[model samples]
Target: MEALTLTTPALLFSAVSLILLAYTNRFLGYASLVRQLYEKLKANPDQVLLDQIMNLRKRLYLIKNMQLLGVASLMFCVLSMFLIYIEVFLPAAYAFGLGLLLLIISLLLSGWEIKISVRALDLHLNDMEHFSEDNS
Candidate 1:
């Protein structure tokens, strides 16, 4: 394998930064949805709203984990760069590899969250379809 260089870890900086920004946006959107749901539930408690809230809760948990892993991956990349700067090639390589692994896991969790999100949207669509059918 080629020697670990500072540039190797530095390459992840932009990708990770973009990913973190996306994750933060997702988190903020969920926060807003939760607040809206809370008010709706208070006004008229329904099973469907309860289920949607539960789904959001799960998605929020996954997002939290995703953000945590992404941040950790970025931290590892920085650490790898620092290690390489100090002439610790072996540890630097390990750190870089771990950072990559964390990033991969974070992305996988993101995919799972997206799937859940789609399912939630599907539920809403189904409800609309049923309502239309009944009206028709």
Candidate 2:
């Protein structure tokens, strides 16, 4: 097998950084939505609003996990590079492989969270359609 170079894991740094940024953006968006929902709940409590809050709670957990895994992946990549610098190729390769595995899990979590978000939006659209039918 070919030896793993420092550059091998170094390439993952940029990709992981971008994924972390995207996760942060999603977190901020959820924070804003939660604040809005909190106020709405205080003004007038309703089942639909409560359901949305529950859904947001689940998505927030998913985003948090994704951010954590992405950071671990980034950390491992750095660790692997340092190992490679010290001429420890075997251990470095193992660390790099772990980093890649973590990144894959993070991406999978992100995709799952997105699917939940879309389903939430679909519920709202269905409500709107029902309202339109009632009006007609």
Candidate 3:
């Protein structure tokens, strides 16, 4: 049986691709959340709705940073791939690792953003319930 040996460049490319795929998936989920938030806003505007908007804006800023980081990471990954032709494995690995780290950071930021959004909605729901009780 013959075993296939994967080159360093190939391994780095694989890792970078996986990170990009995961990042893309995270963005899609965020987009869906944004849509839901919009629908909630259309239903009514209250302190909770205001909070959601503020939270969304903050998350959008993070998304911008994530995009910027992703672009830089891609550039580094490409450079590292080229370096591999010179048999430089360590540097390529480092670049690929940086890209993965950026992706993980973006994912963590997204999770925080979602938590803020949920909390804002919860606050709004509680306020509405309280107001209804006051009228009873």
Candidate 4:
């Protein structure tokens, strides 16, 4: 019987794989929320609700991109891990580094998305103010 020795890159790849999968699930949940918001807006396109719809749409786009990136990164990590196990192809360090880069890219997209969503909500708030004034 031989004991298997896992390299640092292999360990990192496994960690990234798990993290990316979790992120994908979280993004999917966000997508579902956006879908629900869209359905609600379809029923009633009031000024406030319309604003929320717009905000949710922006968030949805961001989440979609994030999910796509996470999936890509996860796939690459899995492939890299398999290659490492087989002891063929490039170094494990390269694989781990690339995976980390992809995760960072996704995180950056998520941050930008949060900023855009906040701006959208602010715009909706202004619309609400205008609607109230018009009613008064």
Best-to-worst TM-score order: 1, 2, 4, 3
Model 3, stretches more than 4 Å misplaced?
1-49, 131-136
lDDT of 4 by residue, 53-99 (tens): 66667777777778777777766666666776887555544665577
Encode model 1's per-residue lDDT on 35-89: one tens digit a residue.
9999999999999999999999999999999999999999999999999999998
Output the worst ten-in-a-row residue range by lDDT, candidate 2. Answer: 5-14
Candidate 4 whole-model C-alpha lDDT, 0 to 1: 0.70
* Candidate with better TM-score, 1 vs 4: 1
Give the winner by TM-score: 1
* Cand. 1 Cα-lDDT: 0.96
Kindly list the per-residue Cα lDDT of model 2 for residues 1-136, writing each as its tens digit: 9999878888999899999999999999999999999999999999999999999999999999999999999999999999999999889999999999999999999999999999999999999999999999
Error of 1 at 18 (Å): 0.7
- Supply the TM-score for candidate 3: 0.57
